[model samples]
Target: MANLQLAVKGEYFDAMIRGEKTEEYRLCNDYWNKRLVNRKYDCLIITKGYPKRDDFSRRIDVPYNGYEIKTITHPHFGDKPVKVFAIKVKLTRSNYVAR
Candidate 1:
C-alpha cells in the first residue's frame, strides 16, 4: 500500500510529533472524500508546511491505525456540528522512517 500525504503546521504538527495527538481530521467534503473514500493507506506522511522532500525532521511518518466518519462540533466547523473523517494515527520513535 501507499502513504497518504498530509500538509500540516503549527500546533497540530507539533502535537503529533510530541505524541500528544493521535488523530487527524478532514472535513467531509468533495475534495477529502475523493482522496480518502475507498482508499487504503499504509501510513500517514505528515509534513510541516511545504518542507523539502528530504527534510525528515520536519516530517512525520506515522502508522495509519484506521479512520471513520463521525459527526462532531469543532472550532473549525463553527457552532453547527458536521461530519468529518477522523484519521487515526500512532506516533512513536520508530515511526519516523528515515530514508
Candidate 2:
C-alpha cells in the first residue's frame, strides 16, 4: 500500500472527520497524478497545515485523520480539459487535534 500525505483546509478537514466528505480532489499536476493513479489501495494522512517551501513537505507532523482509498477518477480539469486525480476514500482513523 502507498502512504500519501495530503493537506486540506480546516473546513474540509472537519467535514472529513465528521464523515460528511467521502472524496477529495487534487489539482491536476504531474507528480500528484502519477502518485495517485493505478493504485489498488493507498493510505492517506490528512492534515490541516501549510506545506513547506519545497511544496511537498508539511510543517505539521501529526495528522488530522487517516483514510483508505476506495476508488479514483481522472477527470478533465476544465475548459482546457486537462487531467486531474480524484479519490474516493473511507475514513479509517481519526487523529484530529484542535490547534
Candidate 3:
C-alpha cells in the first residue's frame, strides 16, 4: 500500500466525495505510469486544487478527503498505447484536513 496525495479540482473533489465520480483519470506520464502500475492498494488524499500547466507553484496543501483505491486500469490514449491511471476509489472520509 502507498499513501499518495493528489490535487484535484473543486468540482471533481465534490463529485468524488458525493459518490458521483468513481474513477479518476491521470495523464500518461513516465513517472506516474511507472509508480501507479501494479500498485494494489493506495491511500489517496484528495486536495482541493488542480495542477496548472503554467504555474506549478499554485497548489493547495489541505486535503479535502481520503479514499481507498479499489481498482486500477491502463487506458489507451488516442491511437497510441499510452499508460493512464484510471483509479476507482471508495471514499474513506470527508472534510479531512491534511497536515
Q: Better model by TM-score, 1 or 2?
A: 1
| TM-scores, each model vs. reference | 0.85, 0.52, 0.52
Error of 3 at 3 (Å): 0.3
Candidate 1, 45-82: lDDT as tens digits? 88889888777777887767768899989897799999
The window of 10 residues in a row where model 2 has the poorest summed lDDT is 56-65
Ranking by TM-score: 1, 3, 2
The lDDT of each candidate is: 0.82, 0.54, 0.53
Q: How far is 87's C-alpha from truth in model 3 (Å)?
A: 1.0
**Pairs with steric clashes in candidate 1:** none
RMSD of 3: 7.4
Output the number of the lDDT-best candidate: 1
Backbone clashes in model 1: 0
Report the Cα RMSD per candidate.
Answer: 2.1, 6.9, 7.4
